[model samples]
Target: MSVETDSHGRLYLSSELRQKYGEKFHIVEYEDRLELVPIDEDPLQAVREAAGDAFEGESIEELRERAREQAKEDAEAGFERGKRTAEGGNE
Candidate 1:
């Protein structure tokens, strides 16, 4: 469908289109053209759907603890490597 903007630079959509896709839209600009993407009314639900099984069986606290432990291990490993280099030992 063809659409034109008014003097105020606002593009009006038909009632049919609005009913089908809701009132909110995200304007996507490409090199040659612009496209309108409908925005989901519930953003949190969209994120939960996109994440799928990422959290699976683990609680938030468990995930945080795992991340902290991994960071600690990585830091210790890096310190050991730096110490070895400082001592002029072969890696």
Candidate 2:
């Protein structure tokens, strides 16, 4: 239940405490205190770790570009799948 500040003076989760909890927790800020809620390891870390620095502190323009790229990829994938299905599911 201690407070910690990062290099930029922003609050940060304690790595030691997180490790002690076996990497299964959710941090919630309630009123003036921080609360830790236990969550299963997967949902707790999967999305975040998978996401990585993809959008970390990115600006609106950068995020829009990423979104555009993702949408283009998705559309291309869908078109490929449709083409395959139309072609009797050929590889």
Which candidate ranks first by TM-score, i.e. highest? 1
Give the whole-model CA lDDT for all candidates, comma-separated. Answer: 0.89, 0.75
My TM-score estimates for the predictions, one after another, are 0.55, 0.39
Question: How would you encode candidate 1's per-residue C-alpha lDDT over 1-91 as one tens digit per residue?
Answer: 8899999999999999999998999999999999999998997567657899776777768978998999999999999999999999976
Worst window of 10 by summed lDDT in candidate 2: 40-49
Tell me the TM-score of model 2: 0.39
User: How well is each residue in 15-65 modelled by candidate 2, as lDDT tens digits?
Assistant: 886676665557899889777786756762555577897657777687779
RMSD, every candidate, angstroms:
5.9, 12.9
Which segments of candidate 1 are over 4 A away from where they belong? 50-91
